[model samples]
Target: MTKSLEGRVALITGASRGLGREIAQRLAQDGASVALLDRKAHWAEDLVAEIESTGGKAVALGSDVSDRKALTAAFESAVSALGRLDIVVNNAMWTKYAAIEDIDEESLDRMLGVGVAGIIWGTQAAAAAMRQQGGGSIVNIASVSARLGLPQAMVYCGIKAAVEGMTRSAAIELAPAGIRVNAVAPSTVATEGVRAMLDEATFEARVASTPLGRLGATSDIAEAVLFFADPMRSGFVTGQSLLVDGGISVALR
Candidate 1:
């Protein structure tokens, strides 16, 4: 760990567990103080404790990213606690696996609310904060589903695609302000949530489809996020969506 992100402050939504938790730990390991925000705020307590135990700075803030006002307040709270905001990872999302026709109105709204609206709100808050500080970075956790349409995942795919679109537009609009916007699109990762969604046979089939012969791990996505978060390494890179899918994004299925 080179402390490349030393003294930088990072705010990550859905930081209680899974990919968000991994991103938080990874950023903290690189020397950035992290603010973990989640709807279930208590879930982040253990992660915050773990980071602190490892001599890293972190705080757990219970806030729903879908709620613009609450999310804005959380962003301010993060800045208040960490002094300044340098990075924002809009990784929170609400999704349900269902066929297009089977999807209900509530599910559709929730997915868009957290997955799409949440990103917009988070970016707006982060961009404002970063402007005051001269510049900053914002990373959105997209998905390979955005590139490949899958059955029973239409809503998820649409929301992710929206995120990618937003990233590009925000990058262009925020660049002049020194705020960079980017996204990471990951394939199926072996997380509890993903495992629950896919059966063993389906998981095996997915692994076979990937060129690397294995499902992605949380650390894989976390590493890509680190690249975008570090200005020294990716200062000139923005509006780009890096795929961390173990080469699956390129395989001609």
Candidate 2:
């Protein structure tokens, strides 16, 4: 309501639903016009419509974040429509739970393509636009899996770890250009995607392991993202991975 982000423009990937959607909504509520990007064009359209219905300005773009050309076009279109790009949230990811031995080449390729390469390409494209605007913030969505390795999430863990590394390195490179890069790592968020994969027993076990004795919600992660995107709040922060995992990372092994 205070409109801290008034006149700012934001682009969010995988914003059709889940954490990405929550992040987009929160940013829009803070008065930033948003571009919702997703592989599912219809989902993007619906999200944009919802936001606009609520008196928020938004545009929907369909593009694969991992595809350089497509992502470039989407980023350019968003900036062209919104007038400038102030924030970019790289939240798209292809994740699956499988044992290391069960993971085949195809699965691995898809995971890395969306998880790792998507972040790399999105960050670079957003940074270029931000540079032109004199500066901006890039928020990469990572996972607690990177810190607390799960048995069936080996590839996902590896991809998130790579994202953290990239965030740090890109922050350093982009600092001189006035662009800030950071990441948010959440654990076992109760999104539809996670709920579908985890049973109540497993979910409870996870919560018990967390120091907070609870699982994370989409809003929990979105709040951290909002903080990082706010120049006034996190202007001095960059190249850092903020964990929004209900203290799961601190649980004793």
Candidate 3:
């Protein structure tokens, strides 16, 4: 069978580590040329080198996704090097867990800016390039927090909910242009970011709540992203948010 994404060019934000890195690696393994973008450019550089060592084509670039100018430049650089753009994975986010009283203005703003505004910038930039190329796909990484509403994660939930809303609206508007926008909402993925915030006991407790009795892995989320990015696999799908949670969202107290 032919690889679904052969000759496709994918630009994945937050490709330095965690779910983003896994997603980039998976797409490259499937024969897509990848542009790995992250604020930690050096991290992406190392990852890109690893991908290249494995016989995949990739490049690393640094850009603050919330900065429209920087994002635009990054997109141009990727196109210049890769020849064209076909997919965008908006996986960058700034997350801080805190109670309402403990949350400060700066932290809240940063979360919204990086998590929400970043998606907007990436989508707009990718949409423009894709429209020019005749079509494309966008996959936004959201969270089950947006639906289940965890304690001390109010700001993070807000940002994710906003992302879901944007995905729907963009899908509706961009459908006519052959651009598909959708989101994946994962629950408690075992990423470096998540590990930093969750202790062994806390992680176990959370996992136990899920019917699957396990936390999600980066590959779990990556597979969901791959499904959305392949037009042939999901050609009829748009304006949807696929929840990658292990039945946690449906759990009853």
Off by over 4 Å in 3: none
Tell me the tens digit of each residue's lDDT in model 2 across 16-91: 9999999999999999999999996688787888889999999999998879899999999999999999999999
**How well does candidate 1 score on lDDT at residue 213?**
93
Q: How accurate locally is residue 200 in candidate 1, as Cα lDDT from 0 to 100?
A: 90
Tell me the deviation in Å of residue 213 in model 3.
Answer: 0.8
Cα lDDT tens digits, model 1, 145-181, are 9999888998899999999999999999999999999
List the candidates' TM-scores in order.
0.98, 0.97, 0.98
C-alpha lDDT of residue 171 in model 1: 98
Task: Give candidates' CA RMSD values in order.
Answer: 0.9, 1.0, 0.9
* C-alpha-based local distance difference test score of model 3: 0.92
Clashing pairs in 3: none
lDDT of every model, 2 decimals: 0.94, 0.91, 0.92
Candidate ordering by lDDT (highest first): 1, 3, 2
lDDT of 3 by residue, 1-253 (tens): 6789999999999998899999999999888999999986787888888989988899999999989999999999999999999999999998888988999999888888899889999999999899998889999999898888789988888899999999999999999999999999999998887888898899889989988989999999999999999988998899999999999999884
